[model samples]
Target: MGFLAGLALLLLGLHLIGEGLSSVKGKRYLLARAFSRPGSLLLSGLLLGLLSGSGTGLSLLALGLLEGGIFSLGQAALLSLAATAGAGAWVGVVALAQREVAEVLLALGLPLFLFRGSRSGGLVLLGLGLLFLGFLEMGQGAKAFAPLLSLLNPGPWALYLVGIVLAFFLGTANGVAALALALMPFLGQGGSMALTLPLIHIRRGGQRGS
Candidate 1:
């Protein structure tokens, strides 16, 4: 139930983001004007991910920017890389947050998800909340399987390989990273870091928009 609800909110946020970008089709050029330098573009991508709190949403915006003839394939790749890093930043922060603090944040944001009167901004908040909530539930579920996880004592290489696959199917590197962080005590630094690589490596790429 949490997974479905989280996915729904994620998709909704993506939709709202797409529509918001389309509505401001005129302003993308403004973005283009700001990102003339490679370093600047990379920085912008990181900032975008951090500000939006959604790498997927930033990817969609990057696609729009590409369509506007603002970003080349190489530039888009850099942007995507930066976006992933940005996402990592969020995951790190969340990993460091107290459990109670996270719950408070989720509770505070629930209304935005329930309330339909909000615009794109609210949708983004709601989506983030749902994503966090989903991750929370997943973490709880994983706790239930702790015994099974403990039985496996794979080498670092094997763990990384499996983590990549698990993260891929899970479809959110942040969630994977958060889980890995939670397991750091049991898995050690090497094993926990292994889980984070999948998030860094699984970024998506597509053709420059038509």
Candidate 2:
């Protein structure tokens, strides 16, 4: 139930983010201008990935921008690379404090969402908060499977395959990473599995971008 709830929240958060971005005034023009320069595009992608904490989400966002004629293919590719890096960085920084950050975002976003002038910004913030909270809930729910995972001593190749499968189902590197971390202590080969999961998800994100 917790995992399912988390998945629902995660999807909802992504939806809200898309809605907020699409509704913002001059958003396309601002994005196009930012993507005009390689450095600025990379920075924008990194910041977006850090905020969204999902390379897959960034890849989809890039695709949407491409379809909207706001970005060239090359720019979109660059954005995906930078965004993946930023998402990895986010995992390292926020893995432990996700709940706190989510609470803070919720506190700030709710009031802003009620005001017409700041609706877009509010939606983005609320989406981010929900994303973080979803990750936390998923991690908690994953604890139930610890005993089952502990029974197997999987090799690196097996772990890689597992990571790929999990990434495919989760559709978000952040969620997979959270699950991996939750189950790490139970696995005898935790180190290799830990490294493989994020790499698999990153590859998946790259593929989606392409």
The numbered model that scores best in lDDT is 2
**Candidate 2 regions with alpha-carbon error over 4 angstroms:** 1-15, 22-26, 34-38, 56-77, 151-162, 188-209
Q: Kindly list the per-residue Cα lDDT of model 1 for residues 1-210, writing each as its tens digit.
A: 443454444344434434433434457777777877899988977866664455675666677777767878777677777875776587655544444654564565566547655444444544455445554554445554456568977678887887888766765565566667656666779888886665555554322331
TM-score of each: 0.60, 0.70
Which parts of model 1 are misplaced by more than 4 Å? 1-47, 51-60, 70-82, 98-117, 137-141, 199-210
> What TM-score quantifies how close candidate 2 is to the native fold?
0.70
Clashing residue pairs in candidate 2 are none
Q: Measured by TM-score, how close is model 1 to the native structure?
A: 0.60
What lDDT would candidate 2 get against the real structure? 0.72
Per-residue CA lDDT of model 2 for 81-151, tens digit only, reads: 88878877766654564688899988998998999999988998898788778767766776676665566
